[model samples]
Target: MQQVKAGGLPAVSTNLDAPKTRLWGERRFRKAAGSALLLCALLLLVSLPFALIGPSVERLVVLVLINVAAVVGLNIYTGNSGILTVGHVGFFAVGAYTTALLTTPPEIKADSLRHLPAFLANSNMGLGESLLIVAVISLVFGVLTGLPLSRLRETSAIVSTFGLLVIVNFVLKGATNITNGTKGIYGVPELVNLPTAYIFVFATIAVAFAYKVSRLGLQLRAFQDNEVAATSSAINPNRRLLEAWALSAVVLGLCGALFAHVIGAFQPHDFYLTLTFELIAMLVVGGKRSISGAVIGTLLITALVEIVKPIESGGGIAGISFPPIWGLTQILLSLMILVVMYKAPAGIMGSRELSLSMFKRPRLSESTIDVASLRAVESRSERPAATLATNAIGIDFGGVRALNDVSIKVETGKIVGLIGPNGAGKTTLINNLTGVHQPTRGQVILDGQEIVGWPSSRIARAGLGRTFQNIRLFSEMTVLENVVSSALARGHLATGVESYALSLLEHFDLAKLADTKSSALPYGAQRRLEITRALALEPRFLLLDEPAAGMNPKETASLIEAILSIREKFALGILIVEHDLHLIMRLCDEVYVLNKGEMIASGSAEKVQNDPKVIEAYLGSQEVRAARRKKTT
Candidate 1:
């Protein structure tokens, strides 16, 4: 069971049960389409009953659908990208104003926007034409605003977006000739009715669902869970976040355009904080992670608003009136949000999409890749070997040197061991080789290309994959997803990733638990999963940091066997940083020992084991030990 944190977002358990989508198949597309249609039908059913009551009720239903479109758009960014934004309604305002100015009659435009630029001043567009323009403009706006904020931490992103909100509101309020300031624009053509709203709402639902299962969406969620692991998988976090933000903006823009027409007229205040707060409340209360949650929250809250407004105005059911209750809707919403924060932080549905999990059929997806086909690729004649070499590479943190004049090389189809006592700079050297740390004074050459200062993601794409000293898994994701997401780094290879990931799982003896959440896996399995995920990058040289750190002798033996098979099958060069001297001595072809951030010995494992300097580093000098013992006595 997932626990909700104080802020209403689920804790570590949030991603434990995310729906797994089968990549590139009719079955997957069919399921998604069926789910969307089912949701649309439910909305129609709810709205139709209210239509028989009166036109006001029908209009209310239309408004609710528009809000659903807006919140679903917001979920694309705030939910998947894990950024809280108060500025989407700013895009809504942009859409509303853009549509109103473009679609209004030339006579109205001349009066209201006399100072408008010639290009915008003369054109009179229909609702459809105006909406098309609004979508493009909002996307551009989202990209521009989201790009700079993409790399920021959560608090910074929130502050930047809130500032964006203020800037947009300022523009709308001050651009009097165009937006007519606080007086608002009048005569926005009423082009959206119940039928039109229904069409757009369903369209939004379909698009959102499609995006949720897309490669981009999966990568975004991976970044959300663990940025470092995502980067190691060759996923560029900032670019993916920008894509989500822009796509969500397009949806919000479309909704805003629809809302403007439905209301027949609107002001800046109509799309300001009031609207922003309401939309955010809906997303949070419904659950930020699911599209269905967005729809449900919008419907429930819209009904609450309607119900409370009548009570606030002293209207009653069947002629039983009561005193006016000011801000009752807002008060009730606040209470509901508080309750949700404590009780069901993941919102109503958590990470689950609308599905048949309740029917108790098999949950695990069987491997679809032919084992023979995978083995055939693995058995092909080995390609030309690649090499990773560092020459006198050094890095300093402030005044302390983490790695000093460290040089190392690993050729394809070999295993090299990095061994040192505590603070001996083994991991630091690995970081330099893998582009995590820029060498202060030397060169990192991969396949003869100088990669000393490249970003980690670029280096990863250049055929370098590494695991962390501490196991870093996409804990909320299934084991299969962890591998498949990494495989997607190959671009067009995404469709075939599921099979490849399954093959990797099978190699590591994790085939049966492929559908299990990574967090739920046994310790050994999680470690194996991390290695499998790294291998998904298909790197020419793989770096394993403390792979056998906590493993028992039996588990280490299995790991050693797996490493041997991987080397023979893929012809990969492996660099392992481990304290398990026995496993290292058995598995590594060559061993390098470090003392005081300097390489002190390098040779065959047997030679290094007997080297006098290596022994001195491991067990302090005789004179030093004698002095220490004398002091203790």
Candidate 2:
């Protein structure tokens, strides 16, 4: 046993190699390999039936596979970022038109597109060459579109992307030389057969699955859950969204190119509103969050279309005659979407991945954090003493001042408390320090560098960690994932992140619940999980807002112990904005009081407790108190 010092506490025996052992002991590689093999097998099984049904049925299967690829591409962005984009079909259109122009013969181009540039008019390429060119073009479009799209959120993003689709359609329709002016491109080579379709679909599935399980995917999902919490953990939401957007654009473009080769011809309308609705319906119906959902939804919706198409054309099925319905397929699809939304809003699979774990017995072993692992994590790095201070900071929202001339300081290895009645601006001050709000005046300094205008992610990376007043855990993610997300944002490698996150979880006694969904945890556990998540950043300063708000005495005691241990072991500054005065007095070395956005008193807990001004702020002024007493009498 190796002895290690914990803050100013007695030395304890620790195992320094425990974390290293756990680091290398992760089973992700083996699991990923196994899952990949399983996915390949599943794809083969699905294709076997369609392959045996002859050429005509095989064609339908290929089309279905193409649609599956498109939906998966859309999911890569919308699913992870929780941002709805209707403009992906624009990339699809670009790919299809670009492919047609490249693969069409020079004579055909010369006849139909008289005004085409010399290079385009003379150029004719093979399927492989055309697809390569199409990918590059799509990537350029992705970056150009993503630059603005990534910065918008919700309705704005959705509306802007729809505008992108409209613009692309208008361009394709008006550009006579490039797209033949909506008379539609023809003479595209038929290069995508059943086997080629299978290959592309399999590749798409593999890419989506791999990305969904990657660190970037986890960070994006965290941002999807809560933007503020994600940024505070140092995850750049816009960067992640932009990355997803670019990748999704490339995938959608490739799918469109493959569709062109399959169909042999297409008009601009083929990749317009109708196609956009169909692809989005597939993703939404299947569950936008999972790769499996995209495949399942595509298959289901494709089958429905196939079954209804004949009836929609006034043809009989199984000797039953039906009237021709011009838009029957769309109507049925709309109805199905309505039913699915009402019954299962998250789609069929929700956020779950299809896995082989169901075939195996549950493991009975517990994952405990030993003392040695704790010491190893604590000793992983050294942190120097630092101060976080807000100097004469003032914040105004609209015409109202939220925080005026609020100045405070916290030094490493010290616990400072901020307490006041409701609307005292404690949280607002924390927000200012953590970069959630910019002060209208004054400066926030960390180790002598002012960082008032920086984004929350940058401030977090500058060694400030914070827990939200509302306890904004990534509700859909697992407890382990929440911690790992913060570590990943802090630049931890995927291979070693599990061990690092697990060490922090163990410190907070949350290791046993690591596999549980964060929203499923008890209220107290959720609070602790938020703190553990913040700790994963290895921050020099931690700002905790209302950590003890809903905790019971036991939980509060445990939290106090954890806080003290963290301050000792990590040598970090802690600023706690808590309403629990007893807990504040017990843990905080110094206290600051605020009244109506202004700092009124600051001193040791005992000194502030007896201050007349502090009492008046909490209760009332002398005259007001006297008036109240007279009224009561």
Candidate 3:
């Protein structure tokens, strides 16, 4: 292994073998192999009963597997992005129609799709060629829809996607030449069967699972948990959401192709609201976050539907005859969804995967500090000093000025303190600096480049990192994942990232709880983890908003030590917005005090402490301050 020195730290190995890299690879491979095996076993277990049962049961299994494939695709986007999509079935319809038009005999297309263009009407492609074409078309649609959808959040995004579905449904019904209108295209080749459906199910499961564990998915999930925090850590929410959206579109398209081949004929209504609701219910009930959940939920819902479907058709149970109940299955399914939502909002698997570890006790081991990896990170941080400064920044909320003429500068290796009482606009100033809010006027210069109006992700990538006053950890993720996601967002090499994250966790004494979910951590630990996550960005300047807010005396003292150590080790410029005067007095090289959105005092800590304006702002009224000062003297 080649070694390179980093400042006063020991030499870091730049070779692949440095710091348990090989061991990590082996563990990762084992886990992946184990998961793959488990999936195969599950497929076999599910197929066993259907295989032994009559052909009728076998057909139902095939349909269930296909539904599972479609729902898994939906989960890839909706589950990770936390953006519920009502339009995915539109992509499914696209796949079904595209494949149907392509693979259908040219004669059939000529009669049914008389208005279709010559190319599609004459096309008589095989299943493979049809599917490839479907994938490309689905990708185009995914990108087009995702561009607008990714920019929205919550109800707006959801409603926008539903609009997409309505538009697609309308297009399908109106475009008679292309889609055969409401009658739909027929004579699609029956190329998918039990084994064929199983193949696609396996592929879908693998893809969804891979995405769930990939860095991009981690960043998306982080954004889902806390948008401001993720963006501050350099995660581009739109890009991640778009990627997942496109991928899921392709998967859903393939599932539609499989469905077309299975049914051999279909109408536009086949892929409309009925199918959309069924797939969504399957995903929600199973657990939207896990591939295992998708499969489990599909199977459970399919069984329920099968059992209830007989009664809906007027079939007697136990030889007891009853009147047919129209929409009985739909009513029951709706009730089941309501119960699941109220009882288990996260679904069956929540954010967890079904793995071999679930069947066995996890072996806990102390994480050893990887010195070489730590040094590698330190080497990356070594750079010329840069300044992050705001020049006469002003912010307005309607007629109210939140901040006016606020200017602050932080250098590469100094700790600057920003202090103010409640509603003094301290946090607002930090917000402008971090790109959470654009200032009405003034410039933010980073290393001499004007960066006002830049996105938070861009600001973070430009080497500025920050923490929120209220903790914003990816609560659903593990402590280690929270840090690793930030590192990955900053483009850290995947091979070395785990070791680097472990080193940071060790620095904060959080390595032992690395596997624990961040939400499970105590308040102080969550605060430290936020700092650790920001440090993973390897930023030149860090903006910490109230890091000492809720820490007890001991935690605050430890936080001071950690902050000081970080500044010395990484040569970082730290701007801390804190109400904790003791921390400011102990750690700040310079203090800037704000009162009523304006800079009231700027000097050493002692000077600011004694400033009359600062005293009056905190204690209220000139008379009261003077009275207290006279009595003290």
The model with the greatest lDDT is 2
lDDT of 3 by residue, 224-277 (tens): 999999999999999999999999999998888888988888988887888888
TM-score of each: 0.90, 0.93, 0.93
Give the alpha carbon lDDT tens digit for every residue of 402-464 in model 1.
888888889999999999898899888887877677889988999999997787888888889
What lDDT tens digits, residue by residue, belong to model 2 across residues 368-411? 43445443343422557899998999999998999999899999
Q: What is the C-alpha lDDT of each candidate?
A: 0.81, 0.85, 0.84
* Candidate 1: RMSD to truth: 7.3
Sorted on lDDT, best first, the list reads 2, 3, 1
Lowest-sum lDDT 10-residue window in model 2:
4-13
TM-score of 3: 0.93
Residue runs of model 2 more than 4 Å from their true location after superposition = 1-40, 357-375, 378-382, 623-633
Q: Which residue pairs of candidate 2 clash?
A: 15-372
